[model samples]
Target: MTELRGEALYWEAFERLKSGKAQIIDTNSPSFKFTKDNVAIEAGKKKGFVKQERYPDLCDSIENTENTRCSAASRDPENSDSIKLITSQKKKANARYSKLKAEHDLCLEKMMNLLRENFELRRELQELKKSSMQ
Candidate 1:
């Protein structure tokens, strides 16, 4: 079987996380957690494979899943301090996600502009070559 790479590997790990197929062995509690290192391990990779700079969409999905899990955990009243901590973490995750999303958009725009410029330069070069040949 061919080994998965790039977006495929990332998405596969995410699917495992979302579907509870990834093993939850390391946690002190049995609760399943959504972490980048876990997802990387799930994808048969070393830690830090799910980088925001490399895979923003996958990172965003993982963050959303983690936030949802935290929200559910926050509903438990047994530990008010834990609930407050989870809420705070959720807020921070959201803010970070927003910032990353903005940065990703700006990067995409810059990439598109560069691609257009490259194409135009190539076309101009071809025209000049043809004129010189004629």
Candidate 2:
């Protein structure tokens, strides 16, 4: 048996993967935070994941009617915290994508082995037919 190296193996693997002739294992879904502080607070309360706020007034109270009174409080610091959480979740998603790609490559290698076996069998069958006809 001749050993395939470098570009030849790479192209063979690429063709097998591209032709949908490979099997892949499914991975579990990744954890991600979808909602910001306000949404999380509301969901936690409804789902009993955490204790509800004791005082509703502790939450944001700015309204159009009170805009003049709380104009200086328009800037919220909690938004930055939520943004950081989302950024970290995105990184985790990227890592999971890379893992899936590696699994696909492994599946392609198995497909190449099956393809080689099929080709060898066809060649042997042709040789046997030639010998019988002679």
Candidate 3:
């Protein structure tokens, strides 16, 4: 699709909205809903939550998709190779998460220790001050 910037984009959107080619969802609208399923899948198909989300626009695009206009992933959403790619990526992601979790837990333990030490030092300082006054 042609990319429109600045006033062109605004005017195009305003015209489309005026002509009823698009829809605007208001807060009190009966169709207004928020769920994890509705979240954008920029993270790819590794997210099962996103797969269950019903997007009318996706179905429309898939049905009307042109080879020239379609993205690489859009070419074949149900391909076996795509599934293999997703599985491989998911495994790598899980490994990275485990590593990060270990590091986070270690850092948290260090923070807790430092806090306890600070409390102990403050208590000792108060006791020393009292002793000096006496």
Candidate 4:
């Protein structure tokens, strides 16, 4: 029996997790955030198996996967504060709306300035034509 190393080891761990063959250790609840140590343990290896310096890709993949899982969990009503999240989202939406409104006003002001310039140019052209006719 040969022991796995590097990418192969992390791949095996992820497979086990996906297949429900292994469970994350040391987590008291489902809401617990996974760490490198958890991945190591899940792979049936020591907590030191996941080294950031040596296995950066594995670590990055684990972090990305965990973030996705956490975000999904956050949307679950039992796992997060729904009212607080809604309030924060609303605040962000209002801030975006205010920014867009300011940009629209600035564009409108520029359009008005251009229209005034066009009017002045037309008035000057009319005066030139009258002088030339005289």
| Highest TM-score scorer | 1
| Deviation from native of the Cα of residue 112 in model 3, angstroms | 0.1
**lDDT of each candidate versus the true structure:** 0.79, 0.45, 0.49, 0.76
Looking at candidate 4, the ten consecutive residues that score lowest on lDDT are 24-33
Per-residue lDDT, model 1, residue 113, is 100
Off by over 4 Å in 1: 1-4, 23-32, 77-134
Identify the superior model by TM-score, candidate 3 or candidate 4. Answer: 4
Candidate 4's error at 85, in angstroms?
A: 18
lDDT of 3: 0.49
In candidate 1, what are the lDDT values of residues 22-122, reduced to their tens digit? 65324434345788878888777888877998777778888999999788767767656765777899999999999999999999999999999999999
- lDDT of candidate 2 over 1-134, digit per residue (tens): 34335323333432333343422211111231211232223222222222225223222221221353234323655655665787998899999999999999999999999999999999999999999999
Report the number of the highest-lDDT candidate: 1
State candidate 1's TM-score: 0.48
Candidate 4: lDDT of 89? Answer: 90
Q: Which ten residues in a row have the lowest lDDT in candidate 2?
A: 25-34
Supply every candidate's count of residue pairs whose N, Cα or C atoms clash at under 3 angstroms: 0, 0, 0, 0
Judged by whole-model lDDT over C-alpha atoms, candidate 2 comes out at 0.45
Q: How many times do residue backbones clash in model 3?
A: 0
TM-score per candidate: 0.48, 0.41, 0.43, 0.47
